[model samples]
Target: MWVFSWMSWRNSLKPPDSLVRKLNRLRRQERPPKREQGAKMGKRPRYHLQGTAFTGIWLLALGFLLFLSPPPDTGRCAPPPTPTAELVVRAKFPAGKPQPPPVTSTAAILVDAQSGDILFSHNATTRLPIASTTKIMTALVALEKLDLNKQVTVSARAVSTIGSKSGLEQGESLTVEQLLYALLVVSGNDAAIALAEAAAGSVEAFVAEMNKRAESLGLTDTHFANPSGVNNTKHFSSARDLAVLARTALQNPTFASIVSTRDFALPPLADGTKREFHNHNVLLGELAWVNGVKTGSTPYAKYCVVVSGSTEGVSLIAVVLGAAEDETRWKEARALLEYGLSLRPRTLLCDRGQLITQLDIGDPLGRQVNVVTDRALVARLSADQVATGTIFWEREARFPIRAGEVLGRLEFTCAGRSLGSARLLAAQSVETPNIDLLLEFWRRGWAPAFLTGRK
Candidate 1:
């Protein structure tokens, strides 16, 4: 059986003679002529039809790209493009000559209510008696130290106060809110003393607190002799200092409301008679923009006024000290406020998210990182200086780079002086890479800019 199986396998392994001849003939058949294939696979000369098709497609794409219109020319009824990154620009202030203010006050200052930027100044820091505006500080202390609804019994000391009386008598009871109205609206000395006693348990102790508050505020030329703002040689403040004080006071909502009130009727008297009083701040309710604030006058202090007003989302604080007459205080205050509000703020020089500049980080990673400002650059310059300021920057940037790290400062200058400075911080972190890792990153398709040394 083994022999028979071997014989069958050998016969099957041998091919038929006719089939072998056919295979050999097919193998010897000639192939068609071919083009030389240089050193690569699949290389061939282009045919006319193939070339025409490729050229047509390319021309179509090129024509489509060229169809776009060019950008509009500047100053031709079109807005400028929004800038993503920009070089620091230079501008001058007071675009034109500014006329002097019609001011008759001995000392005065105009300031932005929120930023404390002095807009206009004349004898700003020369200390002189502040008169009844002193009550502003007293009201601030009371508001901070006492509860609004807390009842205060008018004392003999409060009733004895002579200047600008609120008509409170001994043993009379009133809430702190009512006393504040009397203090701010009527400019009453008695109301001030009552609030002082209510807040600190005594008038003397409250005066001590007032001095301490002045010290903490860094008022170099301010001293408070009394809470009522009576004419005292020691009780003096500058126009700048008073503006600072009024701006701080106006931040309190209760104080703001009280000063702005045209008139208020008090809680009924003991005999059921209603007590009504009007604001002494003549500007309040008289002008379109004028609001809560204070006015004062004495023989020695002349006339002093601290007025705060807002229009079109901008608030201004104006102070006039030692004006020649009562009318002079109001006229000078209005003039100062007009000047402040007339000076429009410039458009944003640099937006909060806009890239201010680039910081170059030499080698390994071998590229630069972007530095952005943390806040918007808004110029608070006088009317003439509005859009005319120069920008400067710190030229050096350090590593190891970090996101949100403060890198440098952007200073805005005009007339050879700094107007303001904005901080420049890193927007993205870029770490230095080791040589081996850097080479590996490049090999594995790192950014082309990094590899080509195009900062």
Candidate 2:
């Protein structure tokens, strides 16, 4: 059976007739002397025909196998991901209520700093990335828990942190106050890390404290996964929550001063080189009215800011998040601040002891007494409210007025609702004229006859 199989395989490799004839012709052309020498030496001569047949068979087999198989895939390269554009969220207003200025931000809010009243908002309670603005809470927590003058040594982990840095070198020593400036003014991620480790002995524990502080401040939509506000799924805050945080932070004098600083210089380092940091908040000097808070940005969070400003006794905190561009956040924040100011415009209606009007004590002689407000009256009214507002006088007592005596009240009312009021006081003493003479003069219903004739 083995011999039969070998014969069959040899038969399968047999060359065609044309190849066989070419081989025969080549053998005939070869010199007889070489064949005789090979025979005499008892050596087996090599045949070109056999080698060519074996190689051609192998090549044909390979070509057949290749033809039967599917082609290998050489995949095209995929394009890199483009950054996502900021979301467009519009605030909804009730019928007849004033709307905030149009802004392009994922979430935004405007609040009255003094009253904590939310003036305007858009998706204000949705949790989203906050970026370096997380330092606001960091500074606040540090101010409360860590001593400003305490010295802290920088760590390797802090020095290796990514994002905005304040030239912090590993093993460098710095005061808490200096790091606070670096954290807020320059949004230094390294400074944030160093402060976190110093405060809680670890980044994890410091983040826990941050969340705890957020919970205490009623920031339900806020969560802190890290001290530096690096891009993390668990690190996020809402516009409303951030505005609330900023308002709380501003209450701390140290925190308030740090965030408002435009430029700060740290003491010389070991190499005798001074490090200077410029605040990332553009609203500080460009808009003279803008006083505080923070600026933040990342690919995920886009650009965000918390802006505080006071104009005409109306203090407002405006937060804009997820703006498409860095400048967009500043522009949107400014618009929100200005719009909030316009919503609740404050006007000085009257100053203490300022004359409001003159009243006639006697009709015939018409002796005038200065009617003044006993206290300053400032009216805070919205656009619609101001449109429906009116001022009126109410008398509480009849005259024979004494200086500084409350004679009446000046009430400011809008839409039948009293906004504010001040007591009307007599600016000077005014004695009553004789009763009989006053009655006779009133009965005449005219100035004295001599004064009328002269006029």
Candidate with the greatest TM-score versus the true structure: 2
lDDT of each: 0.73, 0.75
lDDT at 226, model 1: 86
lDDT value for candidate 1? 0.73
TM-score of 1: 0.57
Candidate 2 residue-wise lDDT, 1-455, digit = tens: 65566445444544447546755665664333455544555433355444455446435543443333222221112231232221111222335645578988899999989779888889999999999889999988888889988999999999999998999989889999999998998888999999999999999999999999999999999999999889999899999999999999998988888878899998878889988878877879887767798998899999988889865446789999999988788888888887876666565655688776776553224556787877776655554444122224344333356888775666654445455667777788755433334434433663344322434
Model 2 RMSD vs true structure: 46.8
Superposition TM-score, candidate 2 onto the true structure? 0.60
Compute each candidate's TM-score over C-alphas. 0.57, 0.60
How far in Å is the alpha carbon of 326 misplaced in model 2? 1.4
Clashes of each: 9, 0
In model 1, what are the clashing residue pairs, if there are any?
91-388, 91-389, 92-388, 93-384, 93-385, 94-384, 94-385, 95-384, 259-292
Deviation of model 1 at 427, angstroms: 37
